[model samples]
Target: MKILVINGPNINMLGIREPEIYGRETYDDLIAYIKEETKLLNIKVSFYQSNHEGNLVDKIQESYGKYDGIVINPAAYTHTSVALLDVVKAVGIPTVEVHISDPDSRDEFRKISYIRQACVTTIKGKGFKGYIEAIEYLVKHHS
Candidate 1:
């Protein structure tokens, strides 16, 4: 199986933007952790991250028939991007939404997730491990 991992907005600022909530692991560290944890699962994983909403939408559109499933952390966009939600629905790929912190437990503004309506599940508060959980969920259920 193949999975596309998509991150949005300030996600590239992991370990720097807000360590109190996002943790001390750099973005590269998170990537390495995902790779290491999933290497033995026999699934191919591809990653794409952008602060630009359009670029993220483009990537999601480009995935089309190219990927079996998607794991997305829309970050700040999760609260506002109806476009992301729409594209995910349009593409019709099995998608899982992930977050390093539990949005429901955060600020009131962070409680919303526009893309959740289009996803198979939402994994939050498990930190980087949430990505692995999402990948594994897709492997077990979507495949």
Candidate 2:
């Protein structure tokens, strides 16, 4: 199975930005963890991270026929970007939206998600484990 993992905005600042909520793991650590997990599952996974919304939309658009499914953590864009949602919807790939921190439990602004409607499932509050769950879900469901 092939899966595209996309993270946006401040995600690259995971360890430094807010160690309390995002944990003390660096972005590279997160990548390594995901790589290790996917290796065991024998799933081909590609990763992308951009602080720009257009770049993210472009990546999602580009995944259309190349990937079996997508695991996305749109970060700040989750609550604001309709373009991201449109592209994900347009791509029509089975997608799982992941959040390291639970939005519903945070500030009101974090609670609104424009991309959720386009995703097959949304996983939250599970930290880095959320990404693993998303990958597993897509691999199991993407036939």
Q: Which candidate is the best by TM-score?
A: 1
RMSD of each: 0.5, 0.7
Local accuracy of candidate 2 as per-residue lDDT tens digits, 1-143: 89999999999998999788889998999999999877889878999999999999999989989999999999999999999999999999999999999999989999999999999999999998999999999888885
Per-residue CA lDDT of model 1 for 34-107, tens digit only, reads 99999999999999999999999999999999999999999999999999999999999999999999999999
Where does candidate 2 clash, by residue pair?
A: none
Check candidate 1 and list the clashing pairs. Answer: none
lDDT value for model 1 = 0.96
Off by over 4 Å in 1: none
Candidate 2, residue 13: lDDT: 95
Please report how far candidate 1 places residue 58 from its true position, in Å: 0.5
Off by over 4 Å in 2: none
> Candidate 2 — worst ten consecutive residues by lDDT sum?
36-45
**How high is the lDDT of residue 119 in model 2?**
97
